[model samples]
Target: MRPSVCLLASAMSSAKGMSPGPMALLPPIHLYRRLLRAHRKHLPPEMRLLGDEYVKAEFRAHRNVENPVHMIGFLTEWQLYAQKIEGDAWVGERLDPGKVEKMSDEQLAQLYELMKAIQKRGTEEGQDGS
Candidate 1:
């Protein structure tokens, strides 16, 4: 096994209730695969297609990131999103107001674009009755 996976496994096995710390995070490839798997297993076909594409693009865009903090934050958020999907807890949930307030303008713009895409897809799906 890769060193990162081994570290994650050891940390998980050793730390029952507490966090396993930063080094225990899943590597980017592992996290990406997990997210794709979660979407495949849980999402409807159209949503899964959109989600997989988005995840792939985002991972590709971030692949050359040199800052560890930004990379860790990105992976951690994606991990949380995957867990939410796997647990069926993402449905009917709204973005938290506080979290929205914390977003930078660029992040907000990306979120707005995503919301528009989702609405567009929803409208298309409604028309298609699928």
Candidate 2:
């Protein structure tokens, strides 16, 4: 068996006699790692940076949490976020007029930064074509 699968099986067996916990449901560290990987693979540049930073901060803050309920809730939320990004349900990079109108000032600023980056790249490409 693969090492990870072996490890998971071991963890599951060990937790069999205990009350159900986040670890019993799924390994928290593994879930966190997968969430980060999903963010990197699926999010746009600016959103990726923001998402990664937020995930890192949340994981770090909750590193020592022992409450299974809180851990499960946290993991569930992050898992859904990762799935949405991977499924292309998140439209962070798309500047839909309705979405743009609802964005907060910080989100608008991030969008502006992304626009600037795109414009810079286009200008460079045009200059190269000359």
Candidate 3:
């Protein structure tokens, strides 16, 4: 058995009012660490920093949550994202024009701004290197 599974089993056995289930049987901190490691290997430096910060903030915000249902949802989403990153399924900042057309004006504006910022940073770096 995986160390996480063992830890989860031990935790469930000791905690009152908590039963073993698939989600509950996966140790979240272990999973989070795995996701971070995967990100380090798969993501570009800027994107990795952003993703790591976002994940850290979200986990910290939910650290005190006692609702198992919500916790499971959060873990499931993050796990899927990690899997996508590790599988090389993510292409950075490249949305289809058709999909962009479907976005709300505010969303489009935000995406445009982000793209511009990334481009500007790249330009600045190129200038610095020369």
Candidate 4:
């Protein structure tokens, strides 16, 4: 419906004898979000930590920028943070990448399981609350 309306509008304008160049469909913000969703799967293994919610938050934070390209810097930061599974929290608390790497494979696997369980519980609680 929307597309038909747009086409009708454009056709009317053309009937008035004006040139119809290409029209920009989605705005910068919408395009930004679509690009993020499209490429999330392409992110490296560790960097996938910053999931949908995290990306949405970052998108909100970058909303002030007129050009969406400015969001590249914010996205880079998010990627780096996500990749640091063993890094310090935003402040100075020690995050030992070496320590995480040195852990036994079983320990690492268990930790991954724990993270999944915690995420699932959190999601359930949020749904229940609402």
Candidate 5:
């Protein structure tokens, strides 16, 4: 739900006959947000944060500032944006995971940082065959 993503959603909502179904929604990225708004009330626990009818469906608010998911979306998109801005330095875009894996150790470390930034893994360490 980055500002750009919100704005994208807003645009979709404003257009006439923009049904909240898979077919009507051309871009899957935009469709993702609309579907959330269309079914906000019934969204599962994991998706409720992205479901805001008023903010996204009503006037199509330019991003839901209150939604925590938006922050994650912003950071994820920002990661790509940063790499894009440093285009020359970024040897491989996020689009090329295979190339990314073969990147230098420094690039690998940077990618790891991006992966860990929003990670929410529960510490479940357990003893194996010791």
Candidate 6:
């Protein structure tokens, strides 16, 4: 079994709660490490660079979060992303419309910036491709 899957199973099997799931099972650090490992194993160099930095920044930003709802949402999204990366299913995928609709203004702005950055990188690579 994959490390993340094992972690999830361990978390669930040990749970005594009413609704134990991914968010309630895996700890933040374990998920963070799993993501980093996935990126290292699956991503190209350029993507790994960007993904690693983004993951570090995000984890650092959320280090002190006290709200369970927010923390659950944050961890759940990252966990899904890790699974996607591990499964080699992330390339060329479009953002989900439902997820976009649920985003706050700040999150939307961040997504816009990420889009612009990706476009800029593609343009630069195209120009250099000769």
lDDT of each: 0.81, 0.65, 0.68, 0.50, 0.43, 0.79
For each candidate, give its TM-score against the true structure: 0.80, 0.51, 0.56, 0.28, 0.21, 0.82
Pairs clashing within candidate 2: none
Off by over 4 Å in 5: 1-94, 121-130
By summed lDDT, which 10 consecutive residues of candidate 3 come out lowest? 1-10
How does model 5 score by TM-score?
A: 0.21
lDDT string, candidate 3, 37-128, tens digits? 98899988876776687678777776766665556556766776777788988765355678668788976786677678668867877999
**Model 2, 56-93: lDDT tens per residue?**
87777777666655565566666666677779887655
What is the TM-score (0 to 1) of candidate 6? Answer: 0.82
C-alpha lDDT of candidate 2 relative to the true structure: 0.65
The lDDT, on a scale of 0 to 1, for candidate 6 is: 0.79
Worst lDDT window (10 residues) for model 5? Answer: 120-129
lDDT string, candidate 6, 65-120, tens digits? 66666766777788889999999999889999999999999989988987887788
Look at candidate 2 and tell me the lDDT of residue 84. 73
Q: With candidate 3 superimposed using the best TM-score fit, by how many Å does residue 48's alpha carbon deviate from the native?
A: 1.2
- Residue pairs with backbone overlap in model 5: none
Alpha-carbon shift of residue 80 in model 6 (angstroms) = 0.6
What clash pairs does model 1 have?
A: none
Better model by lDDT: candidate 2 vs candidate 3 = 3
Encode model 5's per-residue lDDT on 1-130: one tens digit a residue: 3555445544653567766533222232444444454444444543344224322442243234545444434334433433343343433434667666668897577557645532422122122322
Q: After superposition, how far is residue 116 of candidate 3 from its true place, in Å?
A: 9.7
Prediction RMSDs, each to the true structure: 4.4, 9.4, 8.0, 16.8, 13.4, 5.4
> Lowest lDDT 10-mer window, candidate 6?
1-10
Determine which window of 10 residues in candidate 1 has minimal summed lDDT. Answer: 1-10
Q: Considering lDDT, which of the candidate structures 4 and 5 is the better prediction for this target?
A: 4
